[model samples]
Target: MDKILETDGERLLVAVRNLLEAKGLVTTAEITERRAITDAANPGQGARMVAKAWTDPAYRVAMLSDGAKAAEALGIPMRGMPPLGVLENTAELHNLVVCTLCSCYPRAVLGYPPFWFKSAAYRARAVRDPRGLLAEWGTHLPEAMKLRVVDSTADYRWMVLPMRPAGTEGWSEEKLASIVREGDMIGVTIPAA
Candidate 1:
């Protein structure tokens, strides 16, 4: 049989997993089931929460108060995951999220973090020159608006609740959800209606 090479990180992961299984701490079936649940999560789950918050005041309050619970209420699994925090953007304040040390993201809601999100350049620019970073992504905010950059860490994750675009009034939840892109939830871009 041909030899299959693996990176050190990959080898370490395999070793740890094997040890865990050997010790009966976790089973392969359980691991596969958990992986499947995480794999099934997508940006759409976050969009649904944003849409519901846009149309429902109660939901908006709930989402802002407890993001993980709000997601659970919407049938998105949050168990065994770090606590999720929702950053609400307003007319006067804009929120941006970045994992400065690592790519710690709300995977349960936003699925996987984008490649750029994990880049050292992005991590640095987001904190050092947020406005410039936003401009590069075609997201320009007014001069008077305050830009707040929040960091996601292993202990906690964050997602943005972007402001509902104008002219989207009276739109249904599904319609609103359709316009919410992953970038919007990541605070890299604003949703356009």
Candidate 2:
């Protein structure tokens, strides 16, 4: 019989879960439930938050100061995890999230990151050649625009609050949220007007 093998990351994840389960720290049922929670959290959550920020002055302030609290206010469950820092992209600057060491992210907001985000090539180039990388990703900023590459560590997960596109004023929150996709919140792309 040919035995299928798991990838390095899968193996490591299983090992860690096993270690915790053996120590009575966490059970398989709890792990399964957490996985369910993460799976349900897609980029739409981020988009809704962005839409709220675009329309509501008070919620925007709360989200910027306390991302987790703001998310909780919207019924998004976030606990026992590192703080989720919301980075606002303005006309003068752009913000990008990358984990130089590992794939740390706000899973409760952005769901599982894209496959490319976990690649070593992307991790290295996000800091070394951000402009080139963004261009390749179809996000061309103005010449010499200020770009901030935020590293998402285990202590803090970063998400981008993309600037509201022009001509989107007076739009409903659902409409605005529809246009803001996952990559936009990740700062690799801009939402269409």
Candidate 3:
């Protein structure tokens, strides 16, 4: 394996994979390929896409209409992955993404799911009282703004297109992306200008 199974949890996963491969239920090549796909994706890709959307109106339209194609346009691979859906955060609407069934995160775009993201509390409350949850996360939205919680599932993955922060009018795309963290893509926080 290219990844060192240093942690106990990682060693356990290796053991499981080995057993599955030994039984012919799966293969080492398959596991490695999947890992490669997941490993190649990181928050940087998502940030670049978001920054581009913020700077280019045409790309923003494509991003809002077809996130997968938008990602591909920026050379982010989407093969064998679920469709990527970009949810725009506007003045009247704040968007949140969660996977109630399990941690069906957009790992290809946002890397691993955060510890809190996979927690049962976050999964439940995000769908139940998202405003309260966002408040606790330090994203206190105005009471009048509508909060929409979209579910990330096995077939479709969702990510937030956070509103561009103020005071960055002439900033470069790289500068803009620098402030767009993984949490911002997940809608738990907003990027600073």
Clashing pairs in 3: none
1-193, model 3: which lDDT tens digit per residue? 6465555897788788888988999998887897887787899999999999999999999999988899989998887878888999999988899999999888768888889999999999999989889888788989898888998766889999999999999999999999999989988898886
lDDT digits (tens) for residues 83-179 of candidate 2: 8889999989999999989988777888888898899988999999999999887899998679999988668888899999999989999999999
Write the number of the candidate with greater TM-score, choosing between 1 and 3. Answer: 1
Question: Pick by TM-score: which candidate is best?
Answer: 1
lDDT of 3 at 71: 90
Worst 10 residues of 2 by lDDT: 1-10
**What TM value does model 1 have?**
0.87
Better TM-score candidate (2, 3): 3
Q: Which scores higher on lDDT, 1 or 2?
A: 1
For candidate 3, the per-residue lDDT at 4 reads 50
Separately for all candidates shown, the number of backbone clashes (residues 3 or more apart, or on different chains) is 0, 0, 0
List the global CA lDDT of all models: 0.92, 0.89, 0.89
Q: Could you tell which candidate, 1 or 2, scores higher by TM-score?
A: 1
